[model samples]
Target: MRPVDGMRVDVLEYCRVLASQLRLAGLPESRVRVVVQDVLAHVEATGEDPVEAFGQPTDYAAQWARPPGVLRVLGLMVATAVAFPGFWLVLTAFTSPVPWGGAVRVTPFLVSAVAGAAVVGGVYPWTVGLWLERRAGRRVGRGRSPLDAVVAVLTWAVLIVLTLVVVQRVLGPDGDGRTLFSVPRRVLLAVGHGGMALSFVLPSPGVQTMPRSPADHRSWWARVRSLLAGTGNRRRF
Candidate 1:
């Protein structure tokens, strides 16, 4: 049977539209382009229309599955955990002790907070990428994929720095001798984080989740572990 005019219009064009929507949702434009191109290629090779091909998934349960790429999610979780500690320090900054036995008369709480943020900004994405690849039943590429890592690191870092700025303002001014540090100190931290983040905007492996092969056999341990992992966990998030 001949395909309809809509189907013949070109699958790549449809992919382009979808990629644009993904970009609007805040995904990196370059990464979206790559994903669109790959998906379009796959569809073309199968000689199937996108809507018809993906219309009914065989594994509906796996669609929302949270296993496999759990590491990526865990990085975000750790970053959240670090934020809590920073919050505690900020709330108690006035009573918080100065560093190195009071040699520096500054808000120790804010310093601790920035340090915690640095940890989140630097390492979160690499771990997340590893987890994502595992979830897709694929081997994660080693060494720094660099681009996606930069994106993940920078996004979290900027968020952390911005949070610290607000916290600092809430703690009061440096001239009053109550702040953890001066505005200049905070500015330097923000600059460092921003520079690190800009390094991650390029498309790299482990950022996009790919479908796993259904025919692949799982070991008994793998099957058991998979069962323990929740099938779907992101509907609310």
Candidate 2:
């Protein structure tokens, strides 16, 4: 085999080992796929040695096996904090127009209690969690862990409680019908998630999860800068 072919094999072997270790560690299959996705993206982006860039497969998986990073977990929690309230406020638009809105009006103390409960909740409510939820599952039977259940329960509970509080505060004790109607929040969320889940039910004709690695995957701002930088051709014209 050629030198490039050997390198490619080595990378694939490394990915396999990493995936096996994570699965053995009881990390969910979806989460394991994400780790592989990240590794492949990094490898393709910068042709650095996989071992050099990110140690061994078992070591990387071990870190995930261990408790999450303190600050990183806290940051995810903060995102969930903002997102939960935002989702509720979005829902208030619908609930406000209907009757029996007064009963749903959450007292300030109840708001504080629910937020506090969510703060103590053990959940990864940010990017990773969102990614896992969106990924379509093809298999018919899969047993979920209690931790996954806890995370999901805490997530929904937080959103529901947060909605009540924001709805009451903004729309008043008896919610006014006037609100943002351009988008129906609940229906949008349901349809979007449902479609995403349904996509995985049957084999897709020509869809691959992660296709060829892009030459550049920089942020929008970075791309904008490059686009704005003229190559002196504009002056020539």
Top-lDDT candidate index = 2
Residue 59's lDDT in candidate 2: 66
Q: Write candidate 2's Cα lDDT for 1-237 as tens digits.
A: 022333433566566656655653456666777787788779889987676677665566777775235575455455444433333443443454444323233344434434443443324333335323322111101222456557666666666567567656664553333333234445534543443344334222112232212333556675567558853223211
Q: Summarize candidate 1's per-residue lDDT along 1-237 as a digit string, tens digits.
A: 223445443454344334433432345554554555555667868887654544221121123232324464455445444443443333333343444233223464556465555455434433554333332222111222456557666667666677666666666554545644443333333444444454344222233433223333566577557657864232111
- What are the per-model numbers of colliding residue pairs? 8, 0
Worst 10 residues of 2 by lDDT: 134-143
Computed on alpha carbons, the lDDT of every model, listed in order, comes to: 0.43, 0.47
Best by TM-score: 2
Query: What is the Cα root-mean-square deviation between model 2 and the actual structure?
Result: 14.5
TM-score against native, each model: 0.29, 0.30
Clashing residue pairs, candidate 1? 65-231, 68-135, 69-131, 69-135, 72-128, 107-180, 150-200, 151-200
